[model samples]
Target: MPTLKQKPKQRPFCFSVKGHVKILRLVLTVTSMTFFIIAQAPEPYIVITGFEVTIIFFFIVLYTVRLDRLVNCVFWPLLDVINSMVAAVFMILISMLALIPETTTYIVIGGVFGLAASVFCIADGALIYRKLLFNPSGPYQKTAVHDRF
Candidate 1:
């Protein structure tokens, strides 16, 4: 009698490096935002507002980037590069501010999250660059068009 073979178990959620980084950024952003809001540090409303905006943007981009068809758009890679660069810079600055010696515990926690987010953003940017620009066969490469006109 032939025995039936068992199939490999499937993971409920599997993600690539880019996807993982994106998810990391999303979680860190939310954590930092919540901490900042709750900490109620005086002044510097811009930082709070920036976090709010970033949280919203990441939520949307996270969903869009997961769709392969959407990611194939000519502007998608460029947008990802720009977004990650900006986010990294912004997080670095915010983290520094959050790390002030006299800051509260919540601020310090937020700072740590911000730093993590910055690292993830930088990694995401580098990966996007590698995937879309560094490789010869990347999406941004121009192909010769032979027109019969």
Candidate 2:
């Protein structure tokens, strides 16, 4: 009989509070970008929204496969917090720009979506920050190196 090797299965991390937040971020960003396109928002606004969508999607993938654990050189949680904060700031600024008077209804809706996304981003960053601060064995902690026996 021929033998075949099988890889161990890993659990999906994208269903926790952090995971839910990331999914929400993606959904809101996508909706906002669609509305922006329909409303013909400024190029920068559309581009920034696209960037946010990409970043959020990247994090979702990273968490889904537990890649953050394998790549131990970088402090993933801190990096994620920084990303979330920056995303929130950018989203709020662009939403404000989109909510100007005389803007189309689609723009207004997009601006609202942007605002909601920003709030979630802030919440995500805060959650990660708290985890790092309060938990001594948090994800941000570096893993100990051990030699093969």
- Ten contiguous residues with the weakest lDDT in model 2: 140-149
lDDT over C-alpha atoms for residue 73 of model 1: 52
- Residue 89's lDDT within candidate 1 is 85
Q: What is the per-residue lDDT of model 1 for residues 39-97, given as tens digits with 9 covering 90 to 100?
A: 88544523653654565465446545455345555566667778788878878887888
Segments in model 2 whose C-alpha atoms lie over 4 Å from true places: 1-11, 134-149
**Least accurate stretch of 10 residues (summed lDDT) in model 1?**
10-19
Q: Total clashing residue pairs per candidate?
A: 0, 0
Per-model TM values vs. the true structure: 0.66, 0.81
lDDT of 2 at 57: 89
lDDT of 2 by residue, 1-149 (tens): 99998987744677577788789989999999999999898899899999999999888898887898899999989999999999999999999989876479999999999999999999989878876776645455555566432
Candidate 1, after superposition: displacement of residue 69 in Å?
A: 2.6
